[model samples]
Target: MKQRLNIASDTRINALLCSSAAVLLAACGAAGAASAQTTAHVYTMTGAASKDFALTGYDTNPLAGAGSLNGAIASAAAGAAGAQPRLLASVATANPSSSAVTTATTEVTQLYQSLLGRAPDAAGLAYWSQAVASGVPLSAVEAAIRSSAEYISLHNTAGSTVTVPATPYNYYVSPTGSDTAAGTKAAPFKTLARAAKAATRAGTTVWVAPGTYAGGIKTTYSGTSSARIYWVSTTKWGAKVVPPASSTNNNAWDNRGNYVSIIGFDVDGTNSGSGTKWTHGIYTGGSYGMIADNHIHNVAKSVACTSAGGSAIGVDSYYHGVMTDVIGNVVNDIGPAGCTYVQGIYFSTSGTIKNNLVYRVGAVAIHLWHDATNVIITNNTAAASNFGMVIGGGDFYHTSAGANNIFVANNIVYDNKYGISEQGVTGKQNVYKNNLIYKNTTYNTSLRNGLVATATVGSDPLFKGYSRTAAAPDFHLTTSSPAIGRGTATNAYPTDLDGKARNATTGYDIGAYQH
Candidate 1:
C-alpha cells in the first residue's frame, strides 16, 4: 500500500540546517565518497554542524544541480530532521569535475574579453589548449588565467620599471643622498648628481621629491627613447603655497652647463643670501633639450656680472644643440641683482617660449640679444615690467642680420613704457600680428619699432589677475576693453585659453589672450 506524506515546520527547519552543513563539507572535498551509513551520520549531526554555516572552502561549488552535491545535501538534511529512512534513500549522486575543462575555458575567455576588449592572441590561446589537454585541474586553470597577456597589459601605463622617490628624500622635509642607491621615498638622495648617475642606464627611473632644491644642480645623461629621467613634484602643486627659498647671497641655483632638465623646482634667488655675489636662479650654459614647467624667480643679486650682459634667467653664449622648449611657467618679482639690467627670460637662440606668465621684473621682461634666430614667442602675458619685449639681432628693426624669421605673435603687453622694441641691424623678416598693447601712462611714440605690422592701438588688454595665473587669463572684454574683434582672422588664434576652437566669423582678438 502507498503511504500519505506529512511534514511539520520544525522538521523542515531541521532538514534545511542539516543539508546546508553537508553541502559545505562536501564542497571542501571532505569525507570523500561517504558510504551510505556515514551519510546517515552526517544527517544526524546536521543541527550541530549547521551553526557554522558561514564557512566556505576553495573547492566549494555554490551552483545548483552540481554533481552528487544535491543528493549529499538532501541526505544530510533528512537525517538531521529525523525524517523517514526512505526519504534519505531517495537522494541522488553526481560528479561535477568531469566538465571542469569546459568551465575553465569559458572563464578564461570572459576574462580576456573584459580586459583587452577582444579575444586572446594566438600564443595565449595555444597555452590554454595545451594545459587543458594535459588535464590541468580547476586550480591550475585559475593560475593559467592569471598568467595570460591580458593581466600584464593592464599595467602598461607605468611603463617597464616602477618609479619611486630618490633615497633619503622626504616629501615633507629636506632630502640628502647620492643618486646611485635605490631612489626610495624615505631615504632620498639630495643631489641631482645622484639621480643622473642612475638615470643614464635604460629601464631606470629617478624620481625627485618636492622642495626648493638649491642651485648648482646639474646633470648630463642621455636617456633612451623608452626610458627618461623624470623630475616631478612629490605633492600636488608641489607645495606651491610656500614661496621659494629666500637667499641673502647670489645664484641660489645654477645649472652648470648640463644637457638635462632642471624642472619643477621653485628656486628662490631673493635678497642675495651671501651678499651681492650671485643673482641667477638658473643660469644655463652648455644646456640643451627642454626646460619646462618651472617656477623661477628672485635671483638678481647673485648675477652681478650682467655688466658682461647677464639676464635674470640668462641663456649664455655658444648655445648650439640647445634646442630647448620653455613653456607653462610663472616668473615674478625678478631682477633685483646688482646691475640695473634684468630680464625675465633672455634667449640667444632658435627657441620657443609660449604660454608663460611673467610680471614685475626690474628691467625688460623679455630680451633677445645676439645670434638669436628663428625664435617664436607667442601666447604670453607680461604686465608691470620695465619693458614688454626687447629684440636685437646685430640691431633690432633692421632684421637683416642673424635674427631672421622672428615671429612675435599673440601676446598681451600692458602697463609698461613701450610695448615691444625690435631695434638693431638689418635683413630680418619679422611679423608682429594680433597683439593687444594697452593702458600705459608712459606713452611711447613708436610701436613695433614703427614698423608696418598689425597691432591694437588704444585697446586695453584686460587681465584676470595682473600678478597671478595668466595661463587662463579671463580677458572677458568689458565695455571699455577696445580689444574685441580687432584681430586678423587668418592668424588662427585660440579664442579661449582652455583650447577651444575660436569662431572665425568673430575674427581673431588682438592679444595672446582672447575673450
Candidate 2:
C-alpha cells in the first residue's frame, strides 16, 4: 500500500529527545522520499541519524502526483533553529549523483509549467534540475516560483496589485561540462553557446569559470535598462577566449544585445594563425551596454596590411541616444604595424570611452570614425601607434559635414607616429581641453578645421617606468609628473582605470592612472 510520511508532531518530540535520534531516523528514514505535505512548511535536520519533519500551512502545491526520492531521514525534521528547518523533499532522488535525472527534470519542468504557465528556459530548467538533484525540497522550489515576478504578473487580480521581484539567476560555464548538463555551478555548461542559450533573461549573470573557451561566441540576448545581463569571468582574466584555429567566426566576442555587460575576460588573438581570422577582439553592436575591465590584445592579421581588419574593442550603438560605454580596458598589440584602418579601441557610434590604456596598435590607438558623435574620450593613455588618436568621420555620413559635439579631454597622447589629431567637419562647441600632447613623431595637437585643444600642455608625463616595448608597461604617473593636477574638471572622469575614485578635494589627474 502507498503511504505518505507525515511528521508534524513527532519531529518536535524527536528534536526534544535527541537521544533517540538514530532510532527515530531508521524507522522514518523513508521520509526523505516525501513528495508532498504542507509543512507548517517547516523542516529541520539535527546533524544526527533520523528526523521527523513537521507539517503545517495550507496545501500550496496545486499539482498532485509528487515523486518519491530515495536518503537521509535526519533531513526531514521541521523548525528553523538550524540546517534542518527549511529543506522540503528532493526531486525523485535521494542523492545528487544518482540516476534520478528523469524525475529531477520532470519535476522542475512541471513547476515551470504549473507556476509560470510557460516552458522553463534552458538556464532556469538547469538550475531547478540541479537544485532538485541536490535534494532541494520541491516545496521550496514551488515557493520560489510563487515569489517570482512572472507568477505574480500572471495571477494578479484586476483589483489587486502585486509586486513580486524578478529572480536573479546565475548560470555557469566551464570547459569540463557538457551542453546538456544543468547550467549550475555544480553542473556548468561546457560552452558559451550553452550558457547563452540558458541565460536568456534580464538580470541573469553568466559566470565563466576558469578555462579556455573557443572564440567567436555571439551574445544575442538583451536585458532591460534597469536589469542588465552580465557575462563575467569568475577569476580576473582566468577565463580566456582564444581565437578558433579555423572557423567563420570573425569576432572573439560579438555582442548584439542591448544592456549587456561583458566584464573581466581575456580575449587573446595570439592563436589566430589559421582558419577564419579574428577581426574584433570584443565587439558590441548594442546600445545601453558596457564593456569594462577587459584585456583585448593581438587583434591583427598574419598577412600584410589590409582594410578588412577591425578594432580590438569596437562599440556600435544600434539605438541613437543610448550609449555603450567602454571603460577601464587595457588594449594593446591590436593590429599589424602601419595598418591605417586598424585600431586598439574604436567606436563608430556614441559612447563614453574613458580610463583606457592603448599601446602598440596598428593605426590609431583610439579612433573615433564613421558616425561617432557626442562621444566623450577622456582619462586615457595612448602610445606606440600610428596615431595616438585620430578622431574623424568617414564617408558613412556621406556629407561634407562631420560628426559634431565630440568631446576629447584629460588624455595623455604621447610617443606615437602622430599625436591627437582631428580630421573632420567638427563644430566649435566640441570641448577639446586639458590634454598632455607630447613627443610624437609628427605634430602634437593637429586641431585644424574648427577643432582645437585649449590649454594643451606639451610636457613629458613622467612615468614610474617608461618602456614603450615592454609587454607590461607601467603607465603610473610620478608625483612630479606634469600630467598630475593639470586636468580640467570639464569632462573629467570620476574614477581611474584601476577603479580608484579620484581625489575629491585634489584636482583630477590625466592619463589612465590618477597619480
Candidate 3:
C-alpha cells in the first residue's frame, strides 16, 4: 500500500486580545508566525493515515494581510484616500497570472514603453482603458488573444476536409480510347496512368469503368493529411479488373501518410490459369484509410518484390494513425495455388475487420501482426483455410509487451488447423469470448500454447444453409441448435447474418449472428 501525509490536530496559539490593533496582529499570524498576526499553533504533518487540524477563524483581523499578497490588495483598497481604489484596481489589472498572466502583463507593459519611451505612470491610460472595457476578467483578454487572425494563422490546420481533393477523378478506361483527349464520358482515357496523373487531392477517387485495357499501369503520387488516393470500379455489373499477363510493368497505389480509400472492384489473377500477378491492390502505408465494398481477386505476380504476393486487401507497414474500415467486402479464393503463406484480409493496430464473408482462403484467412493493439475482430466468418485466424507479435521493437487489449468476440470461426493461435506468447493480454467454433473436433491441437476457454470448443456451428460456393452464406441459428440461448448472459449477441434483431427480452444467441 502507498503512504501519504495527512493532518492530525490544530495547534492553536492563544493570546490575550487587548485592542483592535492586537486583534489584527493575531489574525495575520493565526496559521503560522508572521509579522502582523499572532502565531497560531501548527502541528507536524506525518504519515498517510494520520489527521491534522485545519486552522480557522482569522477573518476579523485588519492587520492580518501579511501572510498573502491578495490580503494586501484588500488592505490597500480600504486605506486609500480618494482615487486609491482606482490605483489598486490598476495594479490588480497590470499584474499577470502565475503561469502565463505574468508574461502577458510584462509584454503589454513593454509594448507601452516601446511606444511612449518611458515606464507606464499616468500616461498608460490607454492600456488601463482597454482593460476596463474588457470588464476586468482574465478570461475575456485570453479569448480576445486566441480569437485573433494571427493566432489562427500560426496554429490552425487544414485537416482532412481542406487538404484533400473534393472531387474524385471519374475516369473510365474502355476499348474505344480512354477518357484522355475528349475528357468527357464518351472521350475517356486509354489507360489508368492518365487518370492517376490528373489526381491532385489525397483521396482522389478514380472510378475505372468495366472494360479490359491492355498492359500495366504505374503511379507515384502521395496524398496529404486532409486528402487521399482511391482507385475503384464504376460499373453496376460484376466485372473482373486484372493486369496484362505478358507485361512486367506494375501499378503503385501509395498513400504516403494521408487518409486513403478504395472501393468496388475485382482483379482476375488466373488469366485463364497460367497464374499471372499484379503489384498490389488497394495498398496503404498511410493512416485513417478505408478499403471497402469491393471484390479484389486476381493480379499478375511482381518480379521486383517476389515476397510481396498478390493480396486481395492489404495494410502493409503502417502505425498508430492507420485507422482502416475494411467492411462489406467479398474476397474469395485468394493467393496462388502453391504459395506457403497467403492472406485474404490483413490489418494491424486499430482496424475494424467486421461484417465481411471470407472463404476458401489458401493460407491464413484473417492475419493480424505487429503490436496491433485495440483491433476489433467481430462479426466476420472464416472457413476452408489452413488456419482460420492467426495473431503474431505486432510490436516487434517494444520490449514491454507484444500486443495488448485485443478484443476478439462474436466471430464465427470453424474448420481450420487452429481456431486461433499466438506464436509470441510472452506478454499478451487477449480477450477471446462469445464465438461459435465447430466441425474440426479439436479447437486447437496445441492446447497449452493457445489461450481460449476449453468449454467453448465443440462440434459444427450448425449454420442455416451454410454453403461453400454461395454468393452469401446463411449463419442464422436453427430452432434445435445448441447455440440458441446458449450465449453468456452478460455478453449476448444482438443480430444474425441477415441483419435481423436477436432475442431482446431473453437475450440472444452467441457469435456475430443474431437470431
Candidate 4:
C-alpha cells in the first residue's frame, strides 16, 4: 500500500523507526528489499523538539486526525516503541505559558533600558528572545550588554548634568571681608570656613579670591550625587591656604563631606623647622569628591614624631564612601629630609590619580594602601622622590590586606630612590604596565616577596629636557623619544597634563605627555 503525509511548516519532530514497513519513504514509493529488512525508522525535525509535543497512538493512518504536520510527526514518534506501525497525534495545542513569555519580555526590556539607554527594537527583541529560548541565561546576556561600548560611555556620564542655572548658587570669600557680610560677590565673607559653614546645600560654589588665608578649614557639609558642592579658587595659585603658625597637627583644608570638589588653589604646608608637627595640605575623608588643578607643596613632619607623617593630598575613607578623583595637580617639596612617612598623594580606598606632576617629595610620591581597591594611577610624572609609587601592605598601622585591583600605567618615574615598590600584600593584586622608568638610584621596579610587574619598560624616556638638579625642569617628550608612542591606550582620561589629546593618534604616548 502507498501512503502520503504532510507536516506543519515551522514545527519539528524526531522519531525512531523499528520496521521497514514503517519507513518514511519519499513520494510513497515501494520499499526496496534492503529497506524492507530495516529494523528502525528515523525522523528528525528542523528546529522544534519531539519532547516538546505530547502525542497519542492511532492504529489507522497516523495523519487522520493530525491537525498539522507537527501532530503527524508527534504521532509517528509516539508509536516508535510499538511493534505495529502505530500513528500518534499531539495532545496539547497551546504555545508556551504566558508567564514564561512575560518574564522573558520583562528581562529583555530591562536589559535594553539599563545597558543601552534605550528601548529594544523589534529585531533586537527577537534576537534576544531566540537566544534565551536556546538556553542562554538572562544574566549572561545582561553582562554582555553591559560590557558593550555604548554602556560604558553611558556609565561614564551617568551623574553629569548639562543645563546651567541662570544665576549660579555661589558664595564668595576674600581677605578684606567680614564674617558677618553676605557671601555675595559684592560683599564676600572673610574666611573659607565661614563660607563652607553657610553653603550647606548641593550645587553651592564657594569662590575664594586672591590672598593668603590663615587657619585650618574643616567642613562636614555633604552634597548630592548629581549636584556637588564646589570650593574653587577664582584664580589658580592666587588663593592660598596656609596652616596657622601655632597649629601643630592642623591640615590646610580638611573636608569630611561627600560629593565635594576642591579646585585650583595653592596649599602651602610651611615646614618651619625640624621639630614641626605633621600637617597635610589638603586632607579629604569623604568620597565622590574631586581635588583638581591645584598646587600643594612644602608638607613635612618632624623627626621627633616621625611616625606622625603627612601628605600633600590625602584621601581617607573614614566616612563610608568611595570614588575620589585626584587629577591635574602639582605637588612639590613634600616631606623634607629625615621625615620617613610623608607622601605626595595618599589614598586609603578607591580613587583615581592621573595627570599630576609630583616631584621632590621625601617619601613615596603616590601611595595607595590600607584596603585600597579598584584604584588607578596613570599618566603622571613623579621624579626626585624616595619612591615613585608604593602600593602598601600591612605596614605603618594599616593592618588590612594589601590593595586589590590596583592599576598603574603610563607614568614617568625618574631620579627617585625606588621607581616602584610593592610592600606586603599590596603586590599580589596589581597590574603595572607601560610605565617609563629610569635614573632611579636603587631599583627601577621592585616587587618584593614574589611579585612581578605585568609589563614594564626600563629605559630613558628621552624627554625634551629633564634634570634632577635644574632650577626649572621640563618634562615634555621629544619627537624621537621612546615614550612618544609607547603607552597603552586607556579610557581613564581624555587629555594629558598640558591639555593635549591623550590619544592623538593610534597609540597613547607614555607619561604625562601625548607626544
The best candidate by lDDT is: 2
Which predicted model would earn the best TM-score? 2
Q: How would you encode candidate 1's per-residue C-alpha lDDT over 318-421 as one tens digit per residue?
A: 54434455554567777652234767877776677665556766677777776677777776666677777876665322234655667776677787666677
Off by over 4 Å in 2: 1-167, 317-322, 397-401
Q: Give TM-scores for every candidate, taking all chains together and pairing residue i with residue i.
A: 0.55, 0.67, 0.54, 0.64
lDDT, candidate 3, at 432: 69
Candidate 1 worst ten-residue window by lDDT:
1-10
Sort by lDDT, best first: what order? 2, 4, 3, 1
Can you write out model 4's per-residue Cα lDDT over 1-515, one digit (the tens) per residue? 11222221221222222122112111112112111211111122222222322222212223344342344564545634421323222222223345654677678777675444356655446534433433335653454444344433333221121111211266779998889999876788999878978989886777788798874778789888877887777666678887666664457788899988887788876644233344688888888989987889776644342566778899886555589989878888887663558889998878899888898888888988666778899989899888998886454343365677788888888889988887766645677888888888898888755656655667787777787756557888888777777788764477776666666565788787677
Q: lDDT per model, in order?
A: 0.46, 0.69, 0.47, 0.65
lDDT of 2 by residue, 1-515 (tens): 01113331223222211222222222322232242222223333332323333322112331122321112232342332342334444233234554654688799787675555456666455544644665556665565455444444333312111111233566778999889998876788999877877878897777787789988888889988888887877666778989766767778988888888887778998876466788789988888888877889887655456777588998864334258888888899887788887789887777788889999998899987777777899989998888998777765543345556888888999999899878765555567788899999888887766555787878899988888789788899999999888887776667787766676467778888998
Clash pairs, model 4 backbone: 7-69, 8-69, 17-40, 17-41, 18-39, 75-88
* lDDT computed for candidate 1: 0.46
